[model samples]
Target: MRIYNTRTRAKEDFESRLAGKVGIYACGPTVYNHIHIGNARTFLNFDMIRRYLAFAGYDVTFVQNITDVDDKIISQAKQEYGDELASGAMSPEEATQLVAQKYTDAFERAMSDLRMLPIEPPGAYAPRATEHIDGMIEMIALLIERGYAYEVGGDVYFEVRTFGDYGKLSGRSLDDMRAGERVVVDERKRDPMDFALWKSAKPGEPSWESPWGRGRPGWHIECSVMSAKYLGDSFDIHGGASDLIFPHHENEVAQSEAATGIRPFARIWMHAGLLNVNKEKMAKSLGNFTLLKDVLTQGYDANTIRMLMLGTHYRKPLDFSDSALDEARAKVERFANCFRDAEWAVRTADVSEPSEVSELARACDECETEFRAEMDDDFNTAGALGAIFELVAALNVLLKEKAGALPDADAADVRHAATVIEELAGVLGLKIRSNAKETAAHAGEQGRAALRLPDGSAIAPDEDSMSSLRDSATALGLTVEREEDLVLAVLDKRAEARAARDWAASDAIRDSLREAGLAVEDTPQGQRVTPILSSPRDLAHGSS
Candidate 1:
């Protein structure tokens, strides 16, 4: 596999330090607040990378750190309550723990909704920054002893001049960066470009006893210490969003390498591109960022959000908008439907060995090759996703030609395609599952039973009741299907034809439905047909 190394600014063949084994450390969130969609993008991108590696038959150890202590957390807590000890006010420790757990739980829910697979076992080894203070202190002392860091007052800062290759990853010169130093002027630093390794703890804030006195770790040092402690002095890959290339990752390299005397802190440095909102960087300061919970509450599926992020290349900036998300939702729905249909065919179809099946298998293999090749080349997820879509389109054409008489081999190819897509997606932490008829049936029954009206009327619906409802609707010459929880009535026969996989018939049905103010969705349980309203309609009347 080939991956783009930030250090060289070029794609290179990936070789693990240990044969067939990979150790990867990704910079995780600083849990001061709920992570926004932009922050989640980085984790999703790396999850895909890790998943791909493991799918290719490698043992991968993925470690992502949680930065529990930071200036942001302290500042947020102070803003929430006037004083640390105010009655009913959350203390700094309590605030940090509460907010961190809440956001982490929120993040996990978002990941689960997106079907992301966890690389490590649940809570297996997610080391928090506050839990690894001693490691950070040791590294700092080593840097200071080597003259790579200097203590100014009670705080300690990494001396940028001492590290000659400081700007290698960012492709920035010290002088050029110094010119922009006025924006980040820290009077305590020896040079304008020098960044903090440790900050002196403020009064009534969290602190750890270190060689540099009572202080907390600097932003960059946290990752270095935690990563090195978990993955070793030199690991296979270190990844984060592209924004970390500067002082964050660059300083990590300096402190890690200077402390351990390792030529390169990590063999590969992978960075995903930033997410943009309305052609601008999404930042809290800009007041245009969308939180993960807010987006989920707005009724967008988590998988839809994941697909939206994956639609763009990992190394390219992605533009976020409702239109983009809607398009992504449509595609995801289509993919899910295709997989469902293929699985259904597999279970019901007769065994067959045909030349067409072999041809389709060849096509699937070629698609997988293209997908992996694109991924190997700098983790180009956009190209990889395009390859999967192309394969899905081809399978759709095959199903159309065969009229759902998919041969055994062709069915296997379809399954393989799904597996490959999911495996690659796993690298990005996307989970794709194909639910068969039995599971769908049970879920439909359970879901319907859970829906209760405010008036306490039991709307008990069985298959017979559903069939009666269908017949009643059909008497009006309307197509309909009754599932446990839903009454799917097709206002147009053409729409039913489409649901039955008759494209021509379905197209005609869609036009007729549109004329009759109806829209259709082919759900797992059954066809979901609804009337399109110009304005919102009350659910009590069931007219909408």
Candidate 2:
């Protein structure tokens, strides 16, 4: 397999240190708040990589750390407690832990909601940085002993100059670098680039006892220590968002190798590209920064989100917008319908075998071949997804011509086609057949609209047709928070208007909703409320 190594800045052949085992450590969230979409992109990419590696027949050991103690966590605690903390209502450590655990739970819930692969046998794979404080201290002590790190005034720093290969990963000469962001122009530092290994404890913050007194591990040190503990000092892959290529990962490279006396601490350095909204960096200050929970609770499908993300290569910038989600919804439905129809074709098989059956079997084989080729080339999820869709397209043709029931031999082809899609989708962690009945029903309902409300609930399509479309949408697996009530209230009013033969009132409600990016259509079965890609707030504004 070939992987794009961020450290080497080139796509290179990937070989596991052990014959059939691959160990990977992907940098995880800081848990200061609910993880935003940008953070989600990095995590999902790594999860995809891990899943693909396992699919490639390697025994993959994936470890991701939860940074429970951080500067941001402390700041959030101070902001939350304000005067209560000054009055000793709660200690800083208590507040820090509270924030950490709360957000950590939220992160876990979001990952489940997104259907990310849980690092199986979860213990060694998912470690909290706080739980590994001793490990960090031990690594820091080793770095100091090796003259790569030094302690001064209760704080320890990694001497950037001592390690001749310090800038090798980032390709920056020592003199050309500036340490303004994480490093300050401390008079005691031998050079401007010297970074803290252990930070001295400050007021209203969490601290631990180390060789250098009461202090906390630096941002970069925790990852180095955690990765080493779980995946050994040398492992197969190290991955995170591309933005971390600089001082964060570079310092990790320097300290991890310097302390262990090992070369190439991580063999393959994979970094997922950053996400953008309207070509601008997605930041909270920009107000366009979306939370994964927000998107999920707003009625977006998990597969739809994954479909939109995996449609792009991991190393390419992804643009996220409502319209993009709308487009991705169609592709997700197509996949869903293929699975549903293929199953239907298999169940109701004809007695006659057609010449097309052999062709379809061949197509399924070709799809798998193409999928592996794309994935083997730097984890090209976009191309791999295309390969699966091509197979789905071929299956759709067979299903269409057979009038939903293929001949006996072709029925086998139908099953083969569906299994191929499902297995390949699993490699991308797309969660196919996760809810088969719902998958088919969702595809049948043509549901593009989802309501977001205060409580996570969905809108029943309409009162009169509620039994039909509501069940169909629920089967489709669109999510929301308290949106069901508002959705029902408005659609219920329109339903009442229609029941009373009040055309004007019904048209008015439908028109307002249409303006809000919702399409209220009357199908042969019933009224269908579909989203046209606008957010729930937009719907509310239009209705008001």
Candidate 3:
């Protein structure tokens, strides 16, 4: 697999320091507030990368750090709570921890809703910045001994000039950086380009005792220390948003390598592009940032958001708009419906014969091959998803034209195609199955709910209500069937049932629904039940 390395600014073949094993350290959230979609995008992209690597049979160890202490946290605590400790209230540390936990929970929920599959469970081995202060102090001590860092007042700053290859990652010369500098110059620094390694603690701020008096680790040092402590001195990949390419990532390279003498801090440096809103950067100051929960409230599925992110190359900037999300939702529905239909057909058809199966198997193999090829090409998810849609379209066409002629082997082929599509989509952490079923179930519910008694008899729902329900359900990945006067919710319940080995209960539910004038169909998305007719008695008695 080839990955674009920010250090080299080119796509290079992946070569793990250990054979067949990949270690990744991704910069995680600061936990001062709930992470917005832009921040979530970075984690999602790296999650996909890690998933894909493991899918390709490589052993992957992914480590993402939690930045528990930062200037933002300090500022937020003071402004919102009015110095909790000073008022004989909670301490700064206590206040920050409370807010951090709230946002961390929100972030984890967002990731779960988006169906992100971590190589390791969430927070499986996550190292918090505050927890690794010892590691930071040790590294700082080494840097000081080597003359790479110096103490100014109570603070320690890395001398950029001492690192001969300071500008390698960002490709910015020291002179250019100095020329464009806007922040007030600190005369204590040996060079204008030098950045903080450790900041001396201020009065009433969260502080830890260190050799250089009471202080906290700098932003860059937190990552270096946490990564080294958890993933070792060097790892396979170090990922973050594109904005960090400068001082954040560059400084990390300097401090890490200078302390350990490693040629490269990370073997691969993957940077995810920013998510733009209305041609402007998404930031709190801009007042244009959209929270993940707010976006979900606007009726876009979590999967649709994931699809929107994956629709663009990870390295390319993507513009966020309602229309873009709508497009993504539509695309997800199209593929999901196709998968569901194929699955339903496979289950209902008689597989007593084997003729024509070989041809279907060949087609399935071709589709899988195409899907893998697109994914292998730098995770061109857009192209890979296109390939999946193409296969879905082909399967739909085959079913429409040759439903009866499809051999039992052909059913196997269709199943294989669906499996391959789902597996590849999983690498990107997109749950195609949920999108298909949830939409259908919701639509079916709304359709049933809209039914009203006319002259004491049930009738079909109004077009407007049906349309609205369909749109909502389709966006949610559901299929709807309208009977004379009844709507039945259909979904795939077999997977859960089978996992628990409740075969009898699963089959009974299918039979019971069928007896109630509902046809139960199981698909990749889930189980779907369509009502054959509306029953006044059933509606009144809540029997169906």
Candidate 4:
């Protein structure tokens, strides 16, 4: 495996410091408010990389730190929970806790919605900065003892001049940094580049008992401490957005290495490229900030959003646009529909000579090989997707030649191909929706015989409506058949299983139906059946 190391500014071979194990720490969101699309992109990119690493047989211990205690969190908390005007009713400590939990919960939910790795045990562990305050204090104390940091008036600051490799990660020297410096520096600092290691708590703000008096850990100190506590003083990979390459990540390197005397704190420093809206950088001040919910409103599922994000290389800025999302949707639909066709051919094809090798089986082998090769080459998801699309095209060709059916051996080959597609796509966090043919059949039949949308919008089509839908399908070279009705019947049975507390039975039924190319979603009202569309759009539209 190869990953582009931000520290080296080059693509290098990836080798875990510990054999067969990868310890990865990504700078997580500061729980201040709802995360925007830029945050989503950074999180999703690392997630995909993490998934791929696990797929390659590494025991990955992924750690993402939640910056619960930060200047931004404190300010936002005051604005949100404090009383109007000068101060809030709640104290800074109380407000910080409230804001932290609110946005932390929201961030976790967004991760789940994006289908990223789980945040609990047996998945990625998200360590909160508050929980690791002791660790930060200990690290800061170590740095101070090593003559790398100093204390001043209940505050501690890192001495930038003491660290010989201060700007190595960002490839900036003290001279280059000074030339473009903009922020005002504290008069007490030994140097203008010196950054705070611990901040003295102001009145009504959150604070912890430390050697530097009652204060909270500085922004960079929290990450260094938390990452070392969880992933050790040195780990395999440390990742974040490209924007963090400068001050944030550079400061981390200085603090961690100064405390531990390690040459390199993390082996590979991976930073995902920033996200842009159209051609401009997405920012609140620019009035073009996009949230995940906003994209969902455009009829895109989390899967589609993820697919769209992964379409661009991880190190390249992606310009978010509706047209780009539409293209991703189309690609997802193509893969889903192709897999559905392959399954049908496998189920209906006659048994043939088992000894003979099938062309489709060979193609499946090629697809798997190609997919792995592409992924191994610095996790080129774009190249891997291209391989999947080629397999889809091949399967379509086979189905057309066989008149939608194949011999028994050929059917098995088709199934193998479909399974390979599903497995590979799953690694990319792309859920291949079932019942593509049905979804296609009902593509333009929206609101006809519709029960309800995922958002609670109702659609009831009577006899005339059904007739009109059928006419529209015919005109569009589609067929409205009993497949949908059969799907509903299966969903009804699955719902019964759920009602009876037969979770195993219900899950099995859902998987069985999905393999057969039908998407069965159990909504709060009842089971809603739809043609398997790639987008997990809510069923309220009857086209999810």
Candidate 5:
């Protein structure tokens, strides 16, 4: 495998520090407020990278840290609790804890809503900065002893000049960076580029007992300490957003290497590109930043959102637009339908064996190889997806030609092809479920029952109505056979409506099915009821 290293500024063969194990540490969110869509992209991209690595048979341990303690959290906490304090002004610990818990819960819920893979217990190991205060103090003490950091007043600052390789990761000369330094100038620092390692506690603010007096570890030092504590002084890969390369990541390199005396803190450094809106950087200050929930609530499913984010290569600037999302939705729908068709072929196939192998057979046989080739080259998800789409196209052609049934061998090939497509998609974290069937099965008794209107009226099962219904069944636990029966019954009812020329009822049912994630298409072989994956919005939630 190959990966682009931000430190080296080139793509290099990806080899873990250990033979078969890879440890990755990605900078996680600072729990302060609801994360915006841009933040979601960063998290999702790293998740994809982690998933792909594990998929390739590597023993991967992914670590993401939560910045529960930070300047932003402290300020926000003060604003939220200071006014409510009746007695002594709210303590920093009390306020920070309150805000951290609120936003941490919010971040967890957002990740769940986005359908991101769990980063705990079998997923990535998420560490809280506050939980590793001891580790931070130990590292800071070592840096000071090693003549790499110093203390001034109660605060401890990293002596940037002490580490000769200060700006290597960011490729900036120390003199050039100091000249362009726009950070608030601290008068006590030996150099203008020196940064805080431990911050002196202000009155009524959260602080830890450190040799440098009561203080909290600085942002850069926290990551270095936590990462080393969990992933050792050196690990396979370190990842974060490109924006962190300059100051945040560069500082990490300096602190970790200086404290541990390890030359390379991490073997590989990967950074995902930033997200933009209307060709402008998505920022809260810009007032154009959209939250992930905003888009999901607007009727896009997690799968569609994932498609939109992963459609472009991870290193390319992905412009978030409704048009791009729509295109992604269409592609997702197509992929889902292709899978459905392949499954149908397998189910309805009857021939004992094929005289000659089909094109789909070859496509399926080559999928893993082609997919791995694309991913091995810097995790080119776009190219990998192209390979999956090519197979999808082949399967579609085979299904179209072998409409009625397939020979036994042909059926086996088609089934293998379908499985390969799903396997490859899973590597990219694109779970291609037959949305309608899954929704119906998972939607539960109340959800399935709610398919009817309050007025006791019905029509083609539209996409809108079904989406609303499915949303209500989030995290549903049900049976596929039951959902299949429910969908089949609805399809039969629609067929009856059409046979009787009851256009309104037929259309309503069709629309409802479409909304519910079932693709209702009229084929020459009669009406084909294929479950189409729609957005996260309820099938009946906002339908007209």
Candidate 6:
């Protein structure tokens, strides 16, 4: 495998410190508020990287930190509640923790919505910075002992000049970093380029006790300390948004290697590109805020969001817009349709010695090989997605070519191809067939909404309303057992109304089905029933 090393600025052969083990740390959210789409782009891309590594047979240890204590969290706490809740007056620490936990919970929900890799040993794998204050203190002390850091008042700063490789990661030079020339430097520091390792405690902010009085870890120090604690002094990869390279990740390299006496803190540094909204940088303070929840509210699913993000390479800036999501949603629908059609062909198509089954399986194998090739080229996800759809298009042809049940061996081949499709897509952390989970979860409420249509006896598929579905299916000359089957039966009844020129009845069928989280398109092929990827219930709740 070859990975682009940001530190070296070249693609290098990737060899883990251990033969089969890989340790990766991606900087996670600060959790001051719900993450916007731009914030989620980094996490989503890294999740894809992790999934691909695991798919390649590596025992990957991935750890992402939650910055539960930060300047923003404290400030947000003060702005929201003013040091008091309905229960009573709150302490400064209590308010900060409250705000942090609230948004930390929000971050978790957003991660789930995007189907991020399941983090195990939740606490250790997703450590909070506040939980490792002593580790940060220990590192700061080591840096100070080595003359790379110094304490002033209650604040501790890493001395930029002492670290010879300070700008190696960011590719900045000492001359470019001269504070008075191009940057602003704190007056208390010995040099303009120095950065804080620990901040002195302030009146309404969170702080921790250490050898150097009470203060909190600086933003950059939190990741350095936590990653070293979990992934070891010298691990395989450290990653975050490209925006973090200059000060945050560069300082991490200086601090970690300096304190540990290690040449390289992380063998490879990967930084995902930042995202924009219609070519404008997305920032909450600028009123350009586009929360992930709001995107879901606009009736797009996590799958659509993932497709849109993967449409661009991880290292390239992504310009997001509604039209882009619409295109992504269409692609998602294409994949979903292929998965559904392949299953239907396997279940009911006439049995015959199909000419294309072996070819279909070959297509699967070729897609997998090509997928690995694309992903291996510096994690080129856009190219990988192209490989996926090529296979999708090929599989769709095979499914449509045959009209009857496949021969036994051929059916198994088709099934194997479907399995391959699911497996490869899962490597990208996408669900092709499991979308039914979302469909079923919100059936009850959407069923109620469907039943509320004017003069409509729509099929409400909730268990309480199953009898209505059964009667409707019987009237339509169908035996429906599952929710999807009932939806098909509804389409049959809707087709009946259309055939008889009952325009109102046809309109009611379409509207009622749409209300129940299904879309109906009267194509030349037939009345196509589609389960909307976005759930009405979930759209009410939560993004990228």
lDDT of each: 0.69, 0.78, 0.73, 0.76, 0.78, 0.78
Task: Give the alpha carbon lDDT tens digit for every residue of 179-259 in model 5.
Answer: 887867778999989998999988767899988889888999888987887789999999998888989999999999998
Better of 3 and 5 by lDDT: 5
> Model 1: per-residue lDDT, tens digit, 1-544?
8888888888888889999889889888887777788887888888777777877778888888888788787776666654544664555577666666666666665555445666354322467888888888888888999999999888998998998888887889998888855656677778888888889888757777887788888889888888887788999999999988887898899888888898789988999888899899877778889876555534455556777888898888999887787687677777777766666666754434333456667667777788878877877777887887787787777777776566666666666655655665455544444321001011231333211111221222334444454454554465433342233243335446665888866665555444433345665544445434332113212463
Q: What local lDDT score does residue 49 receive in model 3, on the 0 to 100 scale?
A: 81
Error of 5 at 448 (Å): 17
In the range 306-360, model 6's lDDT, one tens digit per residue, is: 8899889999998887778778878888887788777776774343443354777
lDDT for each residue of candidate 2 in 1-544, tens digit (9 for 90 to 100)? 9998877889999889999999999999998888888889899999898888888898888899899988899999999877778999999999989889888877886786677887656522888989999988999999888888889999898998888898788778876686335556679887878888899998878899987889888899989998988889899999998888888999999999999989899998988888899998786667879888767645566787888889899989999888887687778778888897777666656524334448888898899999999999999999999999999999889888988445688787778788889989888877666432121112112333334321232332333343343443353343423433445556666778788999987887787666544567774434666554445346324666
The residue pairs found clashing in candidate 1 are 47-427, 47-428, 48-427, 48-428, 49-427, 51-427, 115-431, 116-429, 494-509, 495-509
Candidate 6 lDDT at 344 equals 71
Q: After TM-score superposition, what is the CA distance of residue 334 in candidate 4 from its true location, in Å?
A: 0.6
Q: What's the alpha carbon RMSD for model 1?
A: 9.6
Of the pair 2 and 4, which is ahead by lDDT?
2
Give all candidate RMSDs, comma-separated: 9.6, 8.0, 10.4, 9.5, 7.2, 7.7
Runs of candidate 1 exceeding 4 Å displacement: 81-84, 87-91, 119-124, 183-187, 352-357, 404-544
Cα lDDT tens digits for candidate 3, 1-544: 6788888888888788899888888888888876777887888888888787888888888888888888888777777677566786887777777767766666665666566663345333567788888989999999999999999888999999999989889999999888876757789988878888888888657888889999888989988887887678888889999999888999999999999998788988989999899877787777888777556534465668878999999888889887787788788888778777777777865544433445555566676787678778787778877777777777788777666666666776677767766776777776676533231112232234333221121223345544543454354345656533333332233345556888875676566445544456664544544434332234323554
Q: Which ten residues in a row have the lowest lDDT in candidate 1?
A: 436-445
Each candidate structure's TM-score, on Cα atoms with residue i matched to residue i, is 0.76, 0.80, 0.79, 0.81, 0.81, 0.80
Between which residue pairs do clashes occur in model 2? 449-531, 453-481, 453-483, 455-481, 455-482, 456-480, 456-481, 456-482, 458-484
